[model samples]
Target: MQIIVVGIGGVGGYFGGRLALTDHRVEFVARGTHGKAIRENGLEVKSIDGDFRAFPYKVHETLDTIDAPDLVLVCTKSWQLEEVAQQLAGRIKSNTLVLPLQNGVESVEKLTGHLDPGQVLGGLCKVISKIDGPGIIDHFAFHPQVIFGEVNGERTERAIALEGVFRSAGIDVILSDDIQLAVWRKFLFICMISGMGAITRQEIGVMRADEHIRALMETSGKEILELAKHKGVGLTEKDLENAFRAIDAQKYHSTASVQRDLMAGRPSELHDFNGYVVREAEKYGVEVPVNAFIYYCLRPMEAKSRAHE
Candidate 1:
């Protein structure tokens, strides 16, 4: 299989490294220092699953350098998805599958706006990881899993084939029948965690342990659930329970990539998480005070960081 991973950050580097382990041709698309490092030293992944060095078939900074791929993983941050999709629009073949391992629920919509709708898949991943440094991905927590499916819930041959490829690389992959719920469930977890972690500047273990912060997290989650309901996304109380379960299971020092970025004064996915929820809540006439408070409180830092970028 000819695969293109568009962003060699945490999600891309680790999973793309796993895919590169196969005999298939997995080309990476990274930029700046990270791209240069990979071209010079190959991609090293420090994973709880296992550590390995992956030399992809090639490392190209831009998609135009590459031809059509059997699969394209848009592993960029939530904010970069639309730009990545636009770049991919011209390169992908008719049969190419474009799967976004992004954090938010709007990825399929964003990709479909730029690429072939049939080619876009609704997807989300479970992994606590980030770039430890240039060319290095540290998968320090959680058992990584990739859950994806066709946007309309069809059991397509291509989806099955792609699932097989992940399984071949020992990734815990799933072909979901209801990908919207899956995406929403994952969003519910990450949005609450990222917002709480960013606002409080605390780790998941700490926040989950503190009664007041735990209440904040729960209220924020409830707001998101109401917003999801207003938007016609099926998110249940059990899904909320699962989200809290994940928080409980996280490593003591685990913090989301968005939280880390906000803390470090770097550009982050604030708009993709709480900001998105707040906007959508306004649109749908749903009250999301907790999410709005989180977004408004942290948005100034986000703007400053982006201005620096």
Candidate 2:
């Protein structure tokens, strides 16, 4: 299948590069310096799995420059979802599938509302990757997974074919029948980490070590889980426990990129991740005190970051 990867940031660059390396018909949609770099030197991925490069890969700056694709991976940050969706409409065919591989749960809703619901496939990516520099994607984890499903939960030809494409490239593909739950589980894990890390200006090592911070993290997770349950999400008590334990077992010593962006005075995705959770928690009358505090504390930092941006 012909694929177009939008927003060639960490997620788009790495996965698209892998598909291209394996001789898949993958085209990258990028802009400015990143686009120039990929065109001049190809896309480079540095990962524990292996380091390799794909040369002469198709790269374009706009939809007009390319043909309609079988799959369009919308990997932009949540804040850019609407704008990207508008541009995507110009290129996507009636049957073109959109897989949103961002950090939040709202992408699917936003994209599907703008485009055809059937054309938008629910997707979630679990990986720690970044664009270290122009044309270079650095992946810190060994496991890179991508999951997607039909909106109606029916197994379709494109859904299965997309899975085959990724698997042929050796990706950890989870073709979920219940993708919404997977997206929520990922949001629950990420929001807590980003919220706590941003407010405290600490990495996972220091944050998890402090009892007060650790408690806050756990509480925030519980608050979100409760909200999910209220919305009739099928998450078990064991699922909640396992989510917490997975973080503990990782022995992580890290902070989210949003925290780093806040500190560096660059616009962060806190509004979409942490801020979104806080807003949702309030509607449910679920008091997420810890998360609420984190949102308020980071307000000034986000303001400062936006001024510079």
Candidate 3:
């Protein structure tokens, strides 16, 4: 299959590198130093499961250089989704399957707003990874896996075929029956810890160990649950329980990409994570005081980062 991976950052670099290891024709879209490094030295993944390198068949900064792809993985930060979607609209064919592996629940909506809805799929991934260098990705923790399915939850032929492709590359993948719920389940955990982690400038273990911080985290999670329920996402109490369990299972020093970005003064997913929840809560008449507070407190820093960018 002709595959295109947009934004070859942590998630993209690792997953796209895995796919590139296969015989499939995988193309990468990246920019600046990272793009140049990948083009020259190949993409490298330092994974706990095992280290591997994938020299993509092609690499480009824009979609114009490539042919229409059968699959496109949107791995940019949540805020960049719209821009990437606009770029993909002209490059993808009718049968292209676009899977967004970013955080938050609005990726599918963002893509469909710009591209054909039929080409979009609900997707999320589980992995603690980041770019260790220009062309190197460090997969430090977790069993890396991709979960994806049609937005409406049908097991289509394309979904099945894609699953086979991932498995053939020796990557773990799940073909979710309820991808929306799966996305929300991941969102609930990420939103609960990420904003607070940024605010506290601490890791998951530190936040979970403190009683006051733990209380704040619980309240933040409840707010997300309320918002998800308002949106009719079918996130249940069991899901909420499982979210906390996932948080507890994380490595002591584990910090979300959003938290790390904020600490490093880089543009972050604050608007996509806490800000999205606050906006949606206001629209649905739900109260999210904790989320609102975190988002407001971090707005100044976020603005400063973006201003410099």
Candidate 4:
């Protein structure tokens, strides 16, 4: 398959690097110093699973220079999704698959608004990783995995084919029958901790250890659960329990990418994570006061970061 990994950050770098090891043709879309470094010295992945490198590989800064791909793995930040999707408008074939490995649940909705709905897939990933340096990705925690499927829940041939390819690359992948539910389950966990982490400027361990913070986190999660219920997503109480368990299972020093981005004053997924919840809650007439408080508290910083960007 001719694959285009659009954004060689942690998720894309690790998974795309593994896919490049296969016989399929793989190209990466990166920008600025990172793209320059990858084109100059190749892409490097420092992973807990194993270390590997993909040199002499194709790297492009824009879609204009690349061919229409059979598969496009979008790893851009949530706020960048619409812009990226617009760029991909005429850059993919009719049957091309676009899977967004972002944290939020609205990726498919956002993409469909820009491109053909048939081209977009519901997807999310589990991993704690980052760009340690230009052209270098660090997978620091979690057993990396991806879950994706058709929006309509059909077990199509394309989904099966992608699953086979991912498996062949030694990737832990789940082809879900209900991809939206999977996305929300992950969202419930991420939304619960990410906003709180950003507000507190602390790691998961620190937040979980504080009674006040823990209570706030639980309330934020329940707010999300209420919103999900209104949206008709199949998120359950058991899913919320599992989400908390997942948070507890993380490394003490573990922090979400959103929190780190906010601390560094970089643009983050704040609008998509907590901000999205707040907006949806208002739309559905659901009360999400905790989520609203966290989002409002961080809105100024988020706006400042985006302004500079």
Per-residue CA lDDT of model 1 for 1-309, tens digit only, reads 999998998889889999999998999999899999999999999987789999999999888898989999889988888888888887889999999999888898888888889888889888878898999999988889999998899998888999999999889999999999999998899988998898888888999999999988898898888888888888878888999998898888888888899889999999989999988988989888899999999999999999998
Per-model TM values vs. the true structure: 0.98, 0.95, 0.98, 0.98
For residues 93-208, write the lDDT of model 2, one tens digit per residue: 89888899988888988886679887898888877788889998898763788988986787888789889999998888988899888888888878878878878787777877
Q: Mind giving the per-residue lDDT tens digits that candidate 3 earns over 164-222?
A: 99998888999999999999899999999999999999999999999999998889888
1 or 4, greater by lDDT = 4
Q: Tell me the deviation in Å of residue 140 in model 3.
A: 0.3
Q: Please state the error at residue 161 of candidate 1 in Å.
A: 0.9
Candidate 2 regions exceeding 4 Å error are none
Misplaced by over 4 Å in model 1 are none
Per-model lDDT: 0.90, 0.82, 0.92, 0.92
Q: Candidate 3: count the clashes.
A: 0
Question: Residue 278 deviation, candidate 2, in Å?
Answer: 1.7
Give the Cα-based TM-score of candidate 1 against the true structure. 0.98
* Regions of model 3 farther than 4 Å from truth: none
How high is the lDDT of residue 14 in model 2? Answer: 75
Candidate 3 lands at a TM-score of 0.98
